[model samples]
Target: MRISLMSTTLAQGVIDWSRDGHVLTAEQKKFYEREGYIVIRNVVPQYELDRYQKRFMEICKMKGVAQSMTVMRDMTIARSEYVPGEKAIMKVQDFGDDPILFDYCKYPAIVDTVKDLIGTPNSNLLAMHTMLINKPPDSGSLTSRHPMHQDLQYFPFRPADFICCSWTAMEKITRANGCLVVVPRTHKGPLLPHEYPKWEGGVNPMYHGIQSYDPKMPRLHVEMEAGDTVFFHPLLIHGSGTNRTNGFRKAISCHYANDDLCRYVDIDKNQEFTANEILDVARKRMKKYGMSEEEAKAVQIDFADIWRLRARAVNGVRQHL
Candidate 1:
């Protein structure tokens, strides 16, 4: 299919968006504006899909964790009786240490898409943290679920509008398979504070009462196949239900910010948290890791290095450049 680029020519003294057209279709822009999210289907290739699947499975086996989502498969339709083993360990966040995962996030198509969405090519890398939510069949493991929250709420940054998230589905995601559900049009309002009581110990808390512009409106479920990806506004309320299809639902999620958007502001409180905050926090955390305070304080937060370490990652050669 031929996708047309909307030549909304960037004027002098104005931002130029023409370069990122491949990923950001004219129609997708409208969807983003109206609904606060957009889904791009079949963006990842079949071979790339298989390649990552094999790698993830191998990693799971190495870590002695559940390799598939089979254990929690029955939870989608009804409560499942299963528990997870103790050997499960999350990999992929530090994927840069692994060449295969690092190259995968750097795929041309993926980067181009991110460029289109971001409207710039010089956008540096964000950390490509990978995760494998492996649940064995009928093991009575606590179901993995995400609370309906915006990315900017947890992310300390400014401008609140420039950052974007790339979610690449590695496993076939469905309603029964536990895909993401988003509250459409919620990205325009102020961020809300959240504190939920423990719904069940060892399980993520049941979050409620985040400030919403339209709580009465219905929620939108985003069901996608492998290779499909969804990009949403930072403030778009989103989360996923439990995996009940008895298989693993693995995905690579990366967050990206424009290089020019240097100003960081807290989305909920609208308070500014500069790049200095990372310097301060990293220093403090280094102490716990057995580093001296002087050493930690001297650790600079390279925005480029930070992006490469923090942006999105999937199995294939795809990334946000």
Candidate 2:
């Protein structure tokens, strides 16, 4: 199915956005348009969640093989003290090459819902970013909090209406254990500037956040149960807090785009900071892979190329990222 989305008209300092539903019911579409997100009950089944958990453990134990995947340890644990690998690993990114983890991206329920929300035909849906997050216990470092930010801050794609994220709770998530917190209706506003939060201890690399926002804006703590999935717009301002509990808070997510509709854009004047930040990261990673500084500079991997490396078609034809 194909539908035109995101006609905008400004009024009273906010832009009104519109969408048409395919798999979504009338009420669900209405809710998403008003709140910037919708939580679908049990979109991920227990069996799939179990498999993901098991695969995560296997990777932690050094038994899984996914050369393209990256395992990120918590900043505190990475900088100090010896903890078992399983406890230190805080996230896994770009796991599309891992057979077990890749299944989450291809899952029909998820792919269809994402396609519906983005108003894109199933033949052109792509999963551009995937991450399995394990919010570790605070351990006094306070690094577990993902500061408030828009997912669009990290993306270079246009037609924000054609991009969405599917986040599934692998275990029950409550406010006490760092559930996702969102600013309602923030997606109706324009893209805002982002920078690393001025945290006292530290934050994980590339974890930039909105530097300023209205504190009085109503906050919604998204308490979710295992297997529950929330589909949200890329411009929605959301973040997770610290995990005060003893166990790791687990969730898996994929950011999907209408591959046929969304195309790369140069970072607008407003987003140059994040673009420079990403360029530094890309070059550093290149060095980690054995490229000399000059060699990495010569490669000229631009912003679009970085996303192209991560984009993988889940439900559709490959097209411009």
Pick the TM-score winner. 2
Candidate 2 displacement at residue 176 in angstroms: 1.1
For each candidate, what is the lDDT? 0.54, 0.82
Error of 2 at 39 (Å): 0.7
Query: Over the stretch 146-251, how does candidate 1's per-residue lDDT look in tens digits?
Result: 5567665545543445556677787678776568889998777666664432345234322332443344568988989888888776778887766566666667
RMSD to truth, every model:
8.7, 4.2
How well does candidate 1 match the true structure in TM-score terms?
Answer: 0.67
Q: Where does candidate 1 stray beyond 4 Å? A: 1-20, 61-94, 125-142, 201-216, 265-321
Question: Per-residue lDDT for 1-321 in model 2, tens only?
Answer: 223233242121221224444567767867887889999988899999999999999888767757567888999889877778579799999998888998999998888777667654434888889999999988887889998999987887767877889999999999878999998899888888888988998888888888886667799999999999999988899999999999999999999877777778766566788877878977888888899989988887777777888888886469677
Off by over 4 Å in 2: 1-22, 120-123
- Whole-model alpha-carbon lDDT for candidate 2: 0.82
TM-score of each: 0.67, 0.91
